[model samples]
Target: MTHRTLFLTGAAIALVATAGLGFGLGRLTDKTPAAAEGHAEEADHEENFIALSVADAAKAGVLTTTVGRGGGSELVLPGRVALAVNALAALGAPVSGAVERVHVAVGDHVSAGAAIASLRGAEGANARASVDVAAAGARAAAAAAARDRRLFEAGVVARQDWEASQAAADKAQAELRAARAQVTAQGTPSAGGLATLRAPIAGIITRVDVRVGAFLTQGGLVAEIADQSAVEYVFDAPPASVGAIKVGDEVLVQRPDGGEDSARIVAVAPSAVDAGAAVVRAKPTAPAPRIGSIVSARVILAKGAGGLTVPADAVQTLEGRAVVFVVEPKGFRATPVITGRAAEGAVEILKGLNGGETIAGKGAFRLKAELGKGEAGHED
Candidate 1:
């Protein structure tokens, strides 16, 4: 046979084989082209599934939450994490004294009652002396009261005299307690009578003005500390929205890093402030983000309002499609979803999910990354 003829015959055979293979696949699937395409897509979806145990998912911080009913409307407001008023400490000089030693500096973290500075002066000496004096007075008064009580019982003293002595003893004892409380609250004066200024709360010191040997008057600012963990979200809402916003309403706070946290409204200003703008406050369910980090707060005006919602972070992009990891008995499956309006750190699931399905929420990004790694490994 000629080479050209041989080539043509081989080409025809290749075409026939291709057609037979296609027909065989169709018969095996018992599906039309569209149906087969769909089946292949489903297989691809299955491949993206992550076979992570619930324990492993928890370890990875892939926290799962039930898809919940969303409110009819959401109130989105600009807000920020702020230090609680009580969490801030402006450490001041407890007495008019010169700083003898500085124990901490700006940016230092100190536990509650940790010393910040030492001041030695007559004030501390006087406080120590007052405690000693109160103790001595208490001892003397108690001895006198005991003598009077015995004399009265022996008919050697009047009842009024015994009562007076008892009163004196009680007053002296109260003074002693006050002195001791003062000593403890202001820190025990050292052997040399140095008063140690200490942190009132656990926090990071933001400022320090005292230096060794510097004289500071009582109540003078020595340093400032802020408990970063003691933070709440504050939002300024329009006056029109203030009426609908209420304490104890659910709040969804979105951090700059894309993490979402749930909170409850803690305070709503009785009236508008700052050019008629109303203020709202929320207590976060978890430790808040850094103070001053700009965040958006979605306040659920009416809880149990109506539609299915999941955390915004629950939705992720996989292969250019919006997907969420729906939990399964054995593992998780990435489900394609159609999303609607988002409010309160939650996005509405318009389709592709039934209410009550558990899905990866706050740390859903971890699962997305995990699924990507799985796809990469399969390709290799």
Candidate 2:
């Protein structure tokens, strides 16, 4: 073939190959939408169920609970364990003095009149010396008054002189009594010019603010003792829920360690606190928790007839709403629920569940996570 003839033939062959390639591309582009639609349909058919084999479910610790009836409405209040007011005592320095010695430490158990510490200072010495002087003066005045009374009866002394002696004796007696009272109020005074600090109530020392050689001013706190045999749970209840809490209502105290104690509402403040929360006090029916422990409280507001109830752990937060996983033959399905009060490990379900529905109790979160994963896969 000549050069011109060869070029024309090559061009024709190239044109045919380009046209075939364009046709193939057109067919692929036309089928792309149908294939994508099929994929979309498959994703749409993906159910919101988490299927697990028996072995897998067992490994996940999936447990089922049947919806039941009977549980009262409860109002949960946040509070801390506090020493009973009548069972607590605050010790303070009776006189300004330097602490000579500290006998007890924080957490020490002490009895009434037990020596806690000793304080030494001029104030204590002066108080004791005044007592001694007052006693001597009183004794001298009493003797003179008795002698003057006898003389007056016999007309051996003037009436004015006898009367004056009697008045002097009475004044001296008053001074003596006042001095003794002062010493008694100051507590026991030691021989070394130290005032001994003593526990006024039998209790466990909860606080000790003084140390050896520490100078304490008068009325300064030395220690705090609490009779924790009886403690009260003081909690702040929302003002909206205060009306439901009445004195004598049953309360459940949940400790930080997951233990529970029963209590009864003893008192409720008439007004709200700074956060518009009411202060409620409850006394434990059994042994109280350690003082100063922060514990959760559930106050039973009212009990109604049998209502739908489920395990509290079964409830989970999904999409910012309370939900529970219902066990189906294929898998578990997440169901939105309206919850009411909760008590004694069970929560009152007002809606979204009928009685006898089997639900995931302990491992519901596993199902929720699986569902989330499936949704994410479909999105991708």
| Candidate 2 colliding pairs | none
> How many clashing pairs per prediction, in order?
0, 0
- TM-score per candidate: 0.59, 0.56
How much lDDT does each candidate structure score? 0.84, 0.83
Native RMSD of candidate 2 (Å): 13.2
C-alpha RMSD between model 1 and the true structure? 20.6
Writing each residue's lDDT as its tens digit, candidate 2 over 1-380 gives: 69999999999999999999999998877767789889777556355667665357758887887888876656677899887879988899988899989999988898989999889977778888888999999999999999998999999999888889989999999999998788777765754567888888898998999988899888999999888786789998766556657999999999889999999999998554456678899988888767788899877765666568888889998887789888778677888876767778988875688777888888777777888888888787
Evaluated against the true structure, the overall lDDT of model 1 is 0.84
Error of model 1, residue 161, in angstroms? 3.4
* Tens-digit lDDT string for candidate 1 (1-380): 69999999999999999999999997887878898789767556347688787789999888888988866547678988898768888988877788889999889999998989998877777778889999999999999999999999999999999999999999999999998887765567854578888888998989999888788887889999998888999898866567667789898899899989999998998543447568898988987878889999877764455667889999999887789899988789999976656767889765678787989888889888887887886686
Residue-level error in angstroms, candidate 1, position 121 = 1.7
